[model samples]
Target: MLRPAASSSSGRRRRSARSRHAPPQRSAVVPSGAPRPPQRLPAAADADGADARPAALSVRPPGPCSPRWAGSGRGYANEPRRARPSQRLPPQGGRGPRGWQRACARACARAPCLGQHQPFAACRGRKRKKERERVFSLPAGGRARWLVLPGSEMAGLTAMEKKLAEYKCNTNEAIQLKLVRFPEDLEDDNTTFNPEYSHQVFGDDEVAFGYKGLKILLYYIAGNLSTLFRIEYTSKVNEKFDCVEADDVESKIREIIPPGFCTNTDDFVSLLEKEVNFKPFGMLLHTYSVHNEEAGEDITYQIYKADMTCPGFREYHERLQTFLMWFIETASFIDVDDERWNYFLVFEKYNKDGATLFATVGYMTVYNYYVYPDKTRPRVSQMLILPPFQGEGHGAQLLETVHRYYMSSPTVLDITAEDPSENYIKLRDFVLVKLCQDMLCFSPGNLMQGFSQEMVMEAQQKLKINKQHTRRVYEILRLRATDMGDAEQSRSYRLDVKRRLIGPYKKKQRELAKMRRCLRPEELTNQLNQIDLNMQHEQLEESFQQLVSDYRRVLERLAQA
Candidate 1:
């Protein structure tokens, strides 16, 4: 009944449905777009020699003193694009679709200039000129700017986009791509953390592994700048700072990093400076560590055995939990721009089976950015997973994870998705069934027209009537515009036309709520009593409504006369 995905390379359209993973924590950026939440040095780190301790993770907040290149792009560096056609031969023995696409992409295209991106790269400036031909022509090297952010930081992305509200040209807010990082090597317990000797790399937020930790990578891209694209890794959650752990971290670094392999930051930086690298102006590399107290001590993945009850760790833990859960699972992403971000999610497991696109849900402008543009963060558009792990309810779990870290506000989180042809909207319904409390309303659909016959006929008739009405209104307005002397009279005539069109419908609706709620019982005695009450109330209010309606009629009639 099916061909194995591993061997099937028959031009199948492998689509990955968006699978949002749960964030370990939540970061609520209140709408004041307040300056990067002030950084208070961790109290645990306040002890002796704390200032001298290595920074496990550094905060790159938006400030006047922030990194100058934080948001300003370096354009497309010409290394990959500047290659000659001879480079397209792929050293004579390259294989696979990635290799093919790479060669094709690099070869036939008009290369862009190195060092800077074209200023007119799809023109966002207000000084519109008649130069339409240039937009189509690729500046010598055809490559354009690419945004690379971690797949999971949808909240931070959203916060950054809000800050860009005033910038009109930042239309490419949400970018889509299959962000595949296939490092040439890999790292593990047997290996050490050496950035210099690395061949390949795979990174999920701040935590990344180098070529010594070999793994296949294939995924999509969206509107994000993968900034933490490095070998050094960190996963921050709730933890009391520990010098011992830092030392252990350093020791571990000693093993993975072989001698003569780049040992220092400069060596690590060079790994990213390779010719075929996707570099964005900024990157928000976020990884979360939840304190699994119940799991007990001596675990390999454990971050701490210390008390989670401490205010700093516990409070920040809660904040992070909420941020991770809410942003990916529940946060509303409204892509105001036409930017459709590409995405790729590499699961812990890679099945040869294609990604079963379980659902395609969407949220409208139910939410806005809370931060201002000067802060300069990549606006998030999606929180999605990769192709290999699509059907196993991971998407829904991801949504729930987001809800856990949600920042409270009024938002309409709607999902628009399609299921397998045989199981249309089934998975979506399953999620809705589970998230009943949090869900607003959903519209399950099929590729069919469901209009009732009566509605169809009525709509057709209304279309003609609407056309006539529009013509009449436009003509009357045009006449009034041309003849100011009769403007007042024409205005009255306009009002008459409007009332004739909508007055009865409005009046009927106003009467319906009262009529529906004030019903009489069917029992004889009860009916009599209800009728008497209804009669009395109706008598008391009948004249009031009639008089008001009549007064309005008189006013209109008088104006016209």
Candidate 2:
């Protein structure tokens, strides 16, 4: 069209323009009949010849919907268009807008075209995830969408709840204790029992936080008290969460039970076979018989007094005292090597094939504390009747047997208890009342009079009862003699007990008068306000009623005896 554009130069000019706009060409040869690879376009340049956008946003291959690929016969135009990273809409139910953005960002990172476009497959997956979330989500200010589920769906919800429930366990319920006599007892469901408490082993809450479906079975052979320790659970806390820790129940139990307990069931069962050779430790103190209603026969029991010097007895004792941790509150191990410590053990004497087999029924510990003027006070420390043997009068039998054993010693000034529990006190009341009822000083006629020094002297000299206990015995006997139906006798009895009950109040009144002399007027008034006389009177009456009720039970039992 004009001097006919320089033919060779025209071709060169067009090629130069294509080089500026298109992706770099590969120098490698292509196999014949193979289509060339798709090329991307470079971003337009500014007047200064610098790229218009960052490299990550500049390079973009032709999409399937693009017109440039339609005539290439590649069938790209027939396919669906992929969304650009920035142009994509978040999926309907996805992790909201944020999740879609995250998906898009991840897709872009893995794109062959750098970050220029998100792939179709990745976008589709994100859309499906969003739809799922939307379907499960509750509407704004509406009830939970899952509430109207069918039975099967409800069961699914329960499974979810159960899954969460496994993380927390009531340790008391989770731990099962059994006194295994036969090998079959281990497998019997009837033989299993739970602990009354686990706060001593766990913490105050008594919860094992990091476990699911926890089952800790502790089995001990009925005879010789050999242990079989085992623990089981569906899942542990560490398996689910990285930050939390589960209770180390085995270690806690180990701290209580001595070394040499069997962890294997076979080992424990083998140990039970040797129990026929197990005899009562120490010297035999007494033998008694009890009627077993379940077995329809009489079973003989033996009591033994053991010390650390007895062969194998020290180790046996270590195994025996471990029961205290499970049953006794505020339980602690004692120094068995101490000479003053005395152990009284009870065993069931059973004959198996003409050989006597002794099974542990219970035990009591007494520490002889030195009293002034060469006398010794034997203090009852810990007493426990194995659960299987409890409620069968073994406790009463063991207690009375121990009392008789101490009564013979001249050095024993009196029998006492260290921080006796309510149950022990009740047992002691019954035993002492039974023992004193036969004495002349505790006769009904003498009891009607009042508590006397004669009662104290006779009880101490004959039974080694302490002065405080002797007074308590007097009251119990007095209540027994009093006729509550007669107003005069009832009034007298009430007034008598009230006088003793009011002792602390009287002492407090004296202290208050002394305080008036020293404390300022405001301080004295504050103290007086705290001591409400009306409340004290009401409490006194309540306490007197309680004491009379307790005394009546003892009398009833005494009558039975």
- Choose the strongest candidate by TM-score: 2
| Tens digit per residue, CA lDDT, model 2, 1-561 | 001123366666766889454422211111222232332122221221111111222122332211110111111222212222321222211233332223222222222232223222222222222212111111121111111222332344343334434577888898888877677888998878777767788767677655778887788877777888888888774422212235567888888888988888888888888877777779998888889888899999988898988888888888888778778878889987689999999999777667877788899999999999899999999999988788777888888888888899999999999999988998898899888888999888888888888989899988999998888788998887888899999999889889999999899899998999999999999999999999999999999999888888878877876
The lDDT for every candidate, in the order shown, is 0.25, 0.66
Model 2 pairs in collision? 93-130, 93-134, 94-130
Off by over 4 Å in 1: 1-381, 387-392, 403-427, 437-561
lDDT of 2: 0.66
Question: Global CA lDDT of candidate 1, please?
Answer: 0.25
Assess every candidate by TM-score.
0.18, 0.71
Worst 10 residues of 2 by lDDT: 65-74
**Candidate 1 lDDT tens digits, 178-218:** 22222221222222111211111111221211111221111
Give residue 149's error in model 1 in angstroms: 52
- After superposition, candidate 2 runs with Cα above 4 Å error: 1-165, 238-240
